[model samples]
Target: MRLALLSPLPPDPSRLAHHAAQFRRALNLGGIDVLTPLVGQRPLESLEAARAWVAERDWRGVDVVHAELAPGQRTVYWVLQALARLPHGPALTATVHAPPGLLGQPLHAPFAGVYHARWLPRLTRQASAWLAAPFTRHIDRRLARRLAGVLCTSDASATRLARRLGLPRERITVLPQGLPELACPPLPSGPLKLLCLSGPGQALRPLQDLVAALGQLVAQGGDDLPPWQLTLAGATAASCFEPPRHDPLTRLQADPRLKALGDRIAWQLDPDPQDLPALMAAHHLLVLPERPQPWGLGEAEPGPTAPQGACDLALAVGRPLLVAQQSGQAEQVTSGNGATYTVGDHATLLAVLQDLLTDPDRLSDWATQARRQATSRQWTQMSARYVGFFQQAVARSTRAATK
Candidate 1:
């Protein structure tokens, strides 16, 4: 079947880009015909141009149009607008990454509002008009009514969206993001190194708290504590709470204990994907301290779902993961052979770090289990699940058309 994979192409760090790349790779491996639009610089603008581009192309043979949703409030609206204009729109399927309620709030809320409160004055004003527009809810409801099928990266994301859109659970499929398989080297014997990978935004507050807790641990434990290093990767210096660019190592440098361990704490800025597997294998543990935002004022804080590419990459490399209890991916980490700590609980984080440092054998055992769990959830498998959903969506649309 010819499938037109609709999504923004590279140079951007969007989840859609990652998914598109993975899906294309998997579909090719499965010997499927996939056609992607020619993406240029400035992808969002390019998406608008795609409608006209697809119209002129030969889409008669295309069986389906699988559009990956962008991470924004007006994603559904944009998709709907594109679909309405397509001359030969095939049966449509969409993947929604963020939860539905997220569309109602300010787009900058999770991106800039939380961490970079200093930038809020300007950023909020810039994004306010877009956030105030009420058209998103209308578009969301319309997409729910029209879409042939929906996909989410996590079960919790799917369930929440299913309820919000008032769609049946069976109509929404949960397909976790796939991680590239990697060969893990033997566990390092020296100081334990922990890696934190996250976007540069308010979402990194949990990571800051964890680092502060680690400093406290170093001061309190002194000689009794095992030698360890915390490597902060994929985040910028601006996001650090401390002024003058608070990269992880810089923040911890104030503590006498941490200051003594020179070259141990490192900050890697935008390392290549090829370097990640080796980095993950070198680290004794991976920590993601992502705290969830309040879901609708009435609901209690929810538990974490599963980790995406970063955590999964660590898992594939046989590294034990440490995530916040409130992270959406916390349950996945704990269940899939990793450890968890209560949100903002530095003592618990420190204790876990210390334990892993002291007992190398235990760390190795967790790593083995983590690798085993990660291998079973490969991108090839995820693509197959997506293809099945696409087939079902086509069948359903055909039935509806006949009726």
Candidate 2:
């Protein structure tokens, strides 16, 4: 079948773009005729072009128009709606990558929230007011009714969308994000080096906690402990670091414990994607300490759902990971493969690190288990599942239209 896969395409690092690329490849492999818009140099320009491009395509040959929608993009939503309303239009299916409910949940802790809160009030107020407003709500209702199917990223997300949109659970499907294939290398001998990969202005507080834990461990006469190092990549922007101008590498640079082991601990400002997997494979443990944010107002309580990309990647590499207990993806981690600790629990983190460093046999066991788990969760397999969901939606939409 000819499928016009409507999405913002790559070399953009946005998650949607990545997913679209993956989807395109999978559809082609499945022998589906796909038409993707040419994404230009700038995003807005490319989106406009894409809309116009899709409008001109022959709908008769297109069995379906699969659009991936991100929340809060009113223009794109309107464009897609217009396309779906076209006379003799193809079937419409939307994959909602980030919905209002998912977006409302804070992905990171204090510092990230502090930055978000600066601009979030106006945005949230506008969005909430718009949803409540009669005309806007009416329009949204019409759009929801017209949509053939909606796809959510997680079961939790699907449930949230069903309640918020008042749509039946049957109308929504859950499709989780997948990781790229990575080879699991044998565990390196000697010190168990730890690595952390994060984007600009992402969570750095967790790294600070790790540094503090390392210092505390050394102070407690754990100097004889096997060497451990941390390599940080992907925080170039100044806003990335928290105040005090002291990063983990900088703080421990001159210290005897880290200095004596020179080059053991290092930070790369930025690394290319191709090099990342190999870099990740070289490490013994991947550490991601994502702190959860409090939800709602007036005696707000900590809500679940911490970021999970790091943990996911670590698992994909088949490496033992140390993630914060509060992270959204912590459920995927297990003692058989890796372990989780409470946020800022330096004592626990230190003990875990020490144990891995001191006990070589246990470290080997963890590494093996981690690799086994990672193999089961490859992106290719995940993509095939997504394709299955898409096929089901297409069939359902066609049946509904015929009736």
Best by TM-score: 1
Candidate 1 local lDDT, 242-273, one digit each (tens): 33222443343365554554565677655665
What's the TM-score of every candidate structure? 0.74, 0.70
In candidate 1, how many Å is residue 343 off? Answer: 2.2
- Which lDDT tens digits does candidate 2 get at residues 1-403? 7777766677766556776887787677666778874345233323355467556666777777777766433335645666757765777778875553322322223322442353455456344444444544455556666667787756666777777667788888775566667778788766778886655324556656666777777667455776777786653444333232224434334556545445656776546555666777888887777543323221122211124555666777788877777655565555487788877787788788778877788778888888877766566666567567668777877787788
TM-score of 1: 0.74
Q: Which ten-residue region of model 1 has the weakest summed lDDT?
A: 297-306
